[model samples]
Target: MERLFGLDMQLIADTLLTAISVFVLFTLASYLFFDTVRDVLKKRQDRIKSDLDTASKEKSDALCYKAEYESKLRDADKEVEEILSAARKKALQNESKIIDEAKEEAARIIARANGEIELEKKRARDEMKKEMIQIATLMAGKVVAASIDEKAQNLLIEETLNEMGDETWLS
Candidate 1:
């Protein structure tokens, strides 16, 4: 037993042997399992990176789709406005056409009424002229047959009007 620095030689030898054993064990574990752990970590990192890329692509696609949808919505709105405007214009045209037709119909009706009025007036005048001619013929025959002074002529005219009656003159 050598005792230098108040430590036993046997204890020092045992401690050194334990340290070497631990070092050897650690070295063997590193050699066997380090590559597998590194490979697993690398695969995990690759998977995470791939997932991130896929997520980013999906996000970009979603943004594009959103933009396209918005554009389409705006186009649809514009189309609707155009359709509405066209409809309004058509409606106004129809209104104007209807008004014009109504005006023309009114004018035709007024013209027809005026023509009928003129025809009625002409007919009434012709009837009056016929009645007047018959009355004049009767008076002439009476005058030629009788030698009439003013008083007799007046009496004859009065008699003739009485015979004709009020109803004849009114008609």
Candidate 2:
């Protein structure tokens, strides 16, 4: 086994110290590795704690934003309701005003029409009265033209009265 790599016993004896030095270096490297791993573990634990705190703060912020949004929505809803109520009231007022104005205008038109009808009736009565008066005057002149005597006028008046019925003439 010693002569397998063609090394002499003298070389082996010379390399014994080198082998011990190499083993010592290996042991020291192993110790350093463990210490570095311990430090990395501690840093990783701290980083995880910080990340957890940040996540918690973000969650709290999200809850706060949600509450604020809900509050704003409620306020907006109230404002909208108030505005709708006011608009409805205004609309009702306008409708009443329009109805009242229309009623007044219709009443005025009806009154004017009634007045025109009364005026037309009165004018027609006056025209009929004028025509009846002219016919009565002409008939009286023709009857009195033959005899201007009082006895002839009395006889004519008696004959005209005899021809009239009580239903056709008031008197």
Candidate 3:
């Protein structure tokens, strides 16, 4: 044995041998567990990817539902407007019909009033004519009592004819 750095040569040889054995054991342990550790990590990564894909699909589905609901709301709004417009048009037509009916009724009433007025005027004229005839007959009787001769009767008659004028022919 050679004495180097005042340490025993046999002790150095034993230490080196122990270090080599530990290194070999460590390498064998790593080789045995590496596949198991890698499999666990790979399974965890696959589960995370699946979860992310599911979440993305759910988000897209929610967006599609929101769009569909918005479209229905818009269609409902248009339908409401159309119904209201149609109701307004019907109301206007009803108003016009009522106005026309009122006007027609007023016209009928006015025509009836005019007819009554004309009828009343005719009745008054007829009554006046009857009174005038009675008065003329009384005057003729008085005249006949005062004069009995043919010449006097003829003179009275001629005077009565001249007073009547063209009014007799009009009646």
Candidate 4:
């Protein structure tokens, strides 16, 4: 029934009542749903933290495995080098032994050849002595059978030397 500043008093009272009803509904909704929303957000945050922790642990384990593999590879390389070095040393020793044996065999062969040459020289000298003795006996028989003057004796000696030949004296 009354009007203030050209607005009805009944309309103002109705707007105030509607605003109070909206505020009461909003408060009730917050009281009922706030705990559920907070719990869901907390659970999501905990799951993300757990996933990050697992990833970090796995990365650390992979790094440790890489280091162990590298160490084993280095040890294998060292063992291979040692085996190659030992093989080279053994090959050198075998070469030296073979060379020494060859030298010893060569020395023995040279010594045997020299001994045979000496034996051949001795046999040649003995044969020459026997030929000379037979020639001297023939010369004595000729001298006793005929009496000769100095000129005839010289002729006989010259003929005996010519019959002996040059090769017999040269040897």
Top model by lDDT, which number?
A: 1
How does model 4 fare in lDDT?
0.81
Please list the Cα RMSD from the true structure of every candidate, rounded to 1 decimal place. 6.7, 6.3, 6.8, 7.3
Write candidate 4's Cα lDDT for 82-130 as tens digits.
9999999999999999999999989998889899888787788677767
Best by TM-score: 1
Q: In model 4, which regions exceed 4 Å deviation?
A: 1-55, 133-171
Q: lDDT tens string, model 3, 45-122?
A: 999999999999999999999999999999999999999999999999999999999999999999999999888777
Ranking by TM-score: 1, 2, 3, 4
State, as a TM-score between 0 and 1, how close model 1 is to the true structure: 0.61
- In terms of lDDT, the poorest run of 10 residues in model 3 is 162-171
lDDT per model vs. reference: 0.85, 0.81, 0.81, 0.81
The total of clashing pairs for model 3 equals 0
What TM-score does each of the candidates earn?
Answer: 0.61, 0.61, 0.52, 0.49
Model 1, range 1-171, lDDT digits (tens) per residue?
665666778989999999999999888888888888989999999999999999999999999999999999999999999999999999999999999999999999999999998887778767865776677567756775676676776677677767766666554
TM-score of candidate 3 relative to the true fold: 0.52
lDDT of 1: 0.85
Deviation in Å, model 1, residue 57 alpha carbon: 2.2
- Please write out the lDDT profile of model 2 over residues 1-171, one tens digit for every residue: 465677778889879978998999888987988789889999999999999999999999999999999999999999999999999999999999999999999999999999998888777767655655565566568778865687776666566546543333321
